[model samples]
Target: MNKIVDLTLNYTNDFTGFSKETSRTIKKDGWNASILTFYSHCGTHMDAPIHFNVSQQTIDKIPVSDFVGKAWVIDVREVGSKGLITVNHIPNDVLNDFVSGDSLVFWTGWSQYVNIPKYRDELPRISKDLANWCVDNKVKMIGVEPPSVADVNNIEEVTKIHQILLKSVVIIEGLTNLEKLQSNCVELIALPLKIEGGDGSPARVIAIEKQ
Candidate 1:
């Protein structure tokens, strides 16, 4: 048996990086629909190398198979707001078992602040050392509950961290519900919208835990 968990935030009128307006109604237009506008980097989104000028790759250019992989969720909830997480924070067992092409997810417990201002402004970020480790180890992707892997407020820090990781690994941010997963490792499938020449796009992410 296996359990599935949705790791994406519910997009709504109040959700960041998204705006929705009713365009049709069932009673009037005989159908229901809305006009959706999404921010490329907002709300459970995936980033392509072009996002940081690291490369010319776009969200649509990514192979669909690259979006799915085995992910090891590292519990990093102890890192507080605006905390810089280094490679040392990752347990030795995870480092020993984590192999090339496997993704790494950080369970920072920051999604609880999704509705407030703190979620983006005071997010925990990955340090440069950790970013180098991801690239050095050939991690396929890095997922975090925060909107960005680096400090969003710092121009230099954010740019440097993103460039390092974007050079080799895909990035998935604004993930939620990691606490519900019972296993440390799971199959993660994160599919992003195929927007032509787009640097990023909102993604629907999920984790399958084997029972």
Candidate 2:
């Protein structure tokens, strides 16, 4: 039997305090509810090229083919808090398993800290070399459990990483529940909301294990 793991964070009005509620009624009748909120990149999300570069592709402009592919989950949990994942963290055997156009998921165990201050302010990041390697190897997409690949406080590094990866590979960030999959390889399907001209959009990411 195969397994499916949802790699998305739960969005709530008070979770991150980033959501807004219009109404909640349960007195004598049923309920018609709505929410007013603003989140460009909150949950499991995909960053389009426009996120870091002007005149670049927007969320809706990205090819749907970029959202689905064979994924290789590289475990780097051994590198402790605030660690940086570099080319060296990736094993040669694992690199050998990747072919051009494969999706790469970094399992940094950081997803455990979603919605926390430290997770947003001090998450692990991918090194420039690793970012370059993803491009050179023709990776279709790169997924990380952290809020951003680079430190959220460091705009320069963050912009550079986004620019590098967004130019070629789709950048999937703020992913959760990857640790539940318990598999090295899986088919990843990440579909972002079709927000017109948006820099990024929340996504529903899933991992499908093969028999």
Candidate 3:
């Protein structure tokens, strides 16, 4: 048996700061479909290197294998709101447990603040040093339970961290319901829309736990 956990945030008008209107619906037009107006980076999404580097690979150019991998969750929720997440927050055992090419997801418990101002203002951020650590360790990707992996309040620092991580790893942001995962290790599948030359795209991220 396999238990699938959805690690995606439900999209709402408030989610992407976009006004969504329906020109067609099952009740009105005999089908359920609506035009969506939202940023590619909005909601649970994967950031490609092109998001930071114009000359880098786009969302479509990234290989499909990168979207699927063995992932482990690290519980860092002990860090409070607006806390700084350094390598010290992670123990040596947890750091050493990771093998190269593994997807590391941070369970920061910040998804509860989704759609709120605190989601961006009070969200905890991964430090530059920690981002560099991931690079040095050859981590394939990093996911977080916040709107961003970096401090949204500090644009420069956010850019720096993104640059550091995007150099070698895929950055997955805005994940929710990570606390529902019962296994430390799971199969992570986060496939983004293959938009040509897209910087980023909202992704449907899920974790599969085998029983």
Candidate 4:
């Protein structure tokens, strides 16, 4: 039998620019209702090219097929904080498993800091070399257990990395629970909310392990 693993972080009020406020109390309205206010890029989200450039593609323009595919989770937990996650981090055997259109997610074990201040601080970021490798290998999409693929402190590099991958591969960031998945290879489905002309959207990511 196969099992499904939810790879998303639950959206909460504490997250930056996120709020679920009561619009009507159950006792007063006889029903439960709330108003949600959040940045489109809040929580576990997928970024579009438009995020880096206003004229570039938006999340709504990306094909649904790009959000789901055969995936491999490359474990790079050993790469410490603010470390560059280079191609060397992946073993040769694991590196050879990549194929065109394959979705790849890195398991850096950073999800544990979700509720901590360090969560948004320095994080293991993908190196330019690895980003180039993904492009050369024709990868379809990439996901990470960090807020962004590039160092958030370096706006220039962040934009560069996003531009590189956005040219071909979709980028999924702020992913959590990647450790709960037992299989290296699984079907990845990370669908983001469709916001017209929006740069990105929070997403619900999941993995389906094959039997």
Q: Which 10 consecutive residues of model 1 have the lowest summed lDDT? A: 9-18
Report the lDDT tens digits of candidate 3 across residue range 1-211. Answer: 8999999988888775545787788888899777778798888999989787834799999889888898888889988798778888776776778789988898999999888788888889898898998899888879998889888778898899999998888889999998899988899999999999899999999999989
Error of 3 at 129 (Å): 1.2
Model 3 alpha-carbon miss at residue 174, Å: 0.4
lDDT string for model 1 (47-137, tens) is: 9999999999998999898899999999999999999888998889988998999999999999999979899899999999999999999
Report the lDDT tens digits of candidate 4 across residue range 26-91: 799889899999898778999988888734688898999899999988889888799898888777
- lDDT at 137, model 1: 94
The candidate that wins on lDDT is 1
Residue pairs with clashing backbones, model 4: none
Instruction: Kindly list the per-residue Cα lDDT of model 2 for residues 127-152, writing each as its tens digit.
Output: 88899999999999899999888887
* True-structure RMSD for candidate 1: 0.8
- Model 3 alpha-carbon drift over 4 Å, by segment: 26-29
Clash list (residue pairs), candidate 1: none
Candidate 2 versus truth, CA RMSD in Å, comes to: 1.8
RMSD for each of the candidates:
0.8, 1.8, 1.6, 1.4
Task: List the global CA lDDT of all models.
Answer: 0.93, 0.85, 0.87, 0.87
| lDDT (C-alpha) at residue 173 in model 1 | 94
